[model samples]
Target: MKRFLSLALCASMLVASASAVSAKTYKMKIHSTGNERNQSTPPLRQFAKTVEEKTNGDVKVTIHFNGVLGGDRQATEGMQLGTIECGITTTSTLGTFDPRFNVFDLPFLFKDYETAYKAMDGELGDMLEKACLDQGLRILAWGVNGFRSISNSRKPIDVPADLGGLKIRCMENQLHVSTFKALGANPTPMSFSELYTALSQGTVDGQDNPPILTFSAKFYEVQKYYSLTRHVFSVAPLVMSENFFQRLPKEYQDVVLAAGKQYEADVRAATENLEAETIAELEKTSMKVNSINDENHKLFVEATAPIYEEAEKLVGKDIVDVARSCLNN
Candidate 1:
């Protein structure tokens, strides 16, 4: 009887050990190139908080901001290699991994935030998410870095004509280069990490980004003119490494997706609010800010009309048509 009791106690202890091991906690490291103050950070931070709270501390997430973990491109590569678990990056750079994403970078595609959100949340978003999965990244939600605006150290760019002879810095996307080439400016594709220094040191004459980045990143101090070109709305996706995501419990996976989708509105609102306030503050500064009316805007569009054709060739006509369908409806 004593021997049987001892064996039973030993088995019970082993079972308890196994149970404790099975209940082990998970930790996630999320990365982004955006600064701590960048509009993109808050939504992700909110997601982390929601995930931690709902999971009862079963999961813990740490965020690396301000390119400390390398820029968006590097972080994405790290995610693919399992060196990192999560990342939020502009979809423009993602085309380097999946060509189909190039369609999203088409200039003048989205008229406003409403139009952009509608298209992204619809079938177009579904298509892009599938493509991301094929590239080994599972998209959690579609987010934003806002529309791009031109800021140059030279004259005000009220029209494409003003861009002549100016060496404009663009994202490392070929289509952006083609668009700028068509407009008569010299387009230089450089990594975002090097942009500010390039501008300050006069390596590039001007660059384009949202108003918030121009103000927050202190590009206004380096560049003299800010134009309301509103050329393209850069879409950012919160993505998890496919391998890492597959290893997650089903309940935790659902929490991640739910938290990601729910917090998108909060990010968008903060970004929009920042734009107006940023523009107001920038107006008080020495930078000369300008916006084109209907005519000049039309001129800018007409100049870049060939971009649609190039986009059709890059991602195929069908994908472009699908995106247009969403925009139209």
Candidate 2:
């Protein structure tokens, strides 16, 4: 009887210890260039939630939005150095490391979000992930920020000629600069954090961003007109340090990747749903919302054609060709 009681006590103790071990906690930080409510919010928050749930509260991901860590470039470099664990930033921001990322900047590259998603979730997405891995970063997933639109105080941009002599804020990417220059605007590449003040202070006459971003940043408050240029389809990548990722246990790595996939779905749904409502809300504030017709779109497209020729040299003609093929298919 004594032997049996001792064995039972040992088994109970082992069960308790195993439960305690399984409850172990891990923490990580993720940073982004936009504020918490921006389109990237869904994915960043969902990713954190999924990681915690998948690990049974063993892993915790804390998100820092709105350039809390730094600008996109700084955050990306920090990821590369393992100073920051994760970040979701524009492909334009990552272009400095891998010029191929500028392929996202190809004007009118994606006809719609469905086509873009197919490319990103399929072969091209895989290629981008491998490219990031080769450059010492791990791209877990891709998220969309929707199509970019033009907003400015100068005038309603009905045609490319209206952009002439207007100073516009653009992401710090050569493709962006070239596109604006081709359209006759003086493109000034600035960090996101500085955009509002630049708009208010008249340092810049206008800028372009997705509706959620323009709404969240309250850019409508300073600017008077919003044009649905839908010029470039924006993509944000969720990336981690390759070195740190490689150090994690295999199971943990799988957990993170799964969390990323879940986040992607959440972000896409949230962004698409919010776009129309955001535009309506902005219009209520008395900002003129103009939808450019197909005729005017031709002018915009003609203006940006040079951007493709210039970008092909930077990211290779093959990459441009592949992306263009996605447009047809």
What range of 10 consecutive residues in model 2 has the weakest lDDT sum? 34-43
What are the per-residue Cα lDDT tens digits for candidate 2 across 1-329? 99999999999999999988776666678988766567677668878887878777777778887788988889989989988989887788778899998899988788788999988987777777888888789888788889999999978999999999999999888888889999999999997779999999999999999988898888988999999999999998888988878766678889999988888888888888889889899889869999999989988888787777787899988778778788786
Please list the residue runs of candidate 1 whose C-alpha ends up more than 4 Å from where it truly belongs after superposition.
2-7, 14-18, 326-329
Quote the lDDT for 96 in model 1: 86
Q: Give me the overall lDDT of model 2.
A: 0.86
In candidate 1 the C-alpha lDDT for residue 181 amounts to 88
lDDT against the true structure, per candidate, is 0.86, 0.86
lDDT of 1 by residue, 1-329 (tens): 99999999999999999989667788888988787788877788899999989877878889988778887889999889888988887787788888889987887888789988998888788889889988889888888878899999989988889999999999778888988888799999987779999999999999988998889988988999999999888888888899888888888889988998876787888888989999999998999999889899888888987888888889888889987775465
Please estimate how well model 1 matches the true structure, expressed as its whole-model Cα lDDT.
Answer: 0.86
Would you list the clashing residue pairs of candidate 1?
none
Top of the candidates by TM-score: 1
